[model samples]
Target: MTEIELNGSSAGLSGLTAVPWKNGSLNEALACYFCPQKTLQADRPKLGKVFTARNLSRIAGIEIRWTTNLADHLRLVDDDQVVFIFHCASFLQLQKSLDKSPFPDSFLQETLDTLALLFPSSDNETTNWLKSLTKIDPRLARCGSLRTRERRLENFNYWHDQLVILKQAFDESSPRNISQWWFDRRNGVQWYTFWIAILVFVVTIFFGIVQSIEGALQVYLSYKSIQSG
Candidate 1:
């Protein structure tokens, strides 16, 4: 087994405490590689009979802590562990990076080559693990940094408050309430007809008023002509 740390803090390793993962170092490395944080735990559901050695199952019981920072990173302290210290950033940005450099591409392939050199293994099993890890780089990017998650949460709350106010306004019984009601296809036709009827009524009333004013003006003109005669 190999110990791989990517852009991980080497300085923090000095003050670390130890944890048990079987009696073997190889097992310990496997445990760290598939640590139980959300990203690591996410890998487990996909693993099958083809991906790992029979002995790998023994280390599966180990618990890997997930962290967004140093405290979470320091929690795993087994020898020969492969630790990937991911820098949390916007999921959107991470996704963009992934899209620009997809898995097994030239840049990613070169990156994996360096990782393979760090971990040195000839077993085809190692390829499976690298493939899985490769899948993870992009996924972690998609999961995003903690800040983006918080902003999404804040946005949800703001929209929720606005919706609540809209609902309250909608529920109150008044002529205005009719405008707030949601329209379905069946009701939309009726709503359109109602508006058309109202528009026609307004036009008719305006025409009637204009006709009445015209008649009154004519009568006044006739009376003025009689007075002049």
Candidate 2:
């Protein structure tokens, strides 16, 4: 009987590598994209928004456009914030699956709680984190954890689509955010309404003062006439 060895080619190099993100990072930047997988798996975040905060950016050589729609500007602000967060925070730089077990439940809960406090802000951080953790290939959408071909393929396709959305949102534009809420020039109505409000305020104040002065003058005149009589 011949004993066959299975565990082969091993580059034996080991040391205590300093961990980058120590779980309290993403929230430190005050912005991030919540991972869909983490959210689904941990059930920590209950929000559906894209970003955790709004950011203004003026990167070198990037032309920032002014958007008339306040809502759209805010949507892009979310993107800017996410990108800024990614650059500033050490959240996603952690070693993927280097542990024997999945991410700690406590860590996941902490992340979820942090994100819960930052709901309604859409971001691409989580999206990027998921792609990295899964080690997804652009050419191959795959979940390394899954075993069944059906589940693996589905996850791969799903992640690929998510990556597309994440890229689109992140790569849409440069920072320089502009919001025209009540001051949109394109809407003549808003302009007219603004002036009309000012006019109304002035007129109301003017009439009120005039009425008081007139009443005082009338009373003075009556007293003077009585004294003269």
The numbered model that scores best in lDDT is: 1
Off by over 4 Å in 1: 1-186
Global lDDT of each model?
0.34, 0.32
Clash numbers, per candidate? 0, 8
lDDT of 2: 0.32
Per-residue accuracy of model 2 over 1-229 as CA lDDT, tens digit each: 0011124422222111111233455333122222233212312112223222221122211223322111121122333333211120122213233353233433333332322222212234433533454322221111112222322212322122332333344334332322322323334675578668878999999999999999999999999999999
RMSD of each: 21.3, 18.8
Q: Give the TM-score of candidate 2.
A: 0.24
Cα error, residue 215 of model 2, in Å, equals 1.6
Lowest lDDT block of 10, candidate 2: 84-93
Which residue pairs clash within candidate 1?
none
TM-scores, in order shown? Answer: 0.24, 0.24
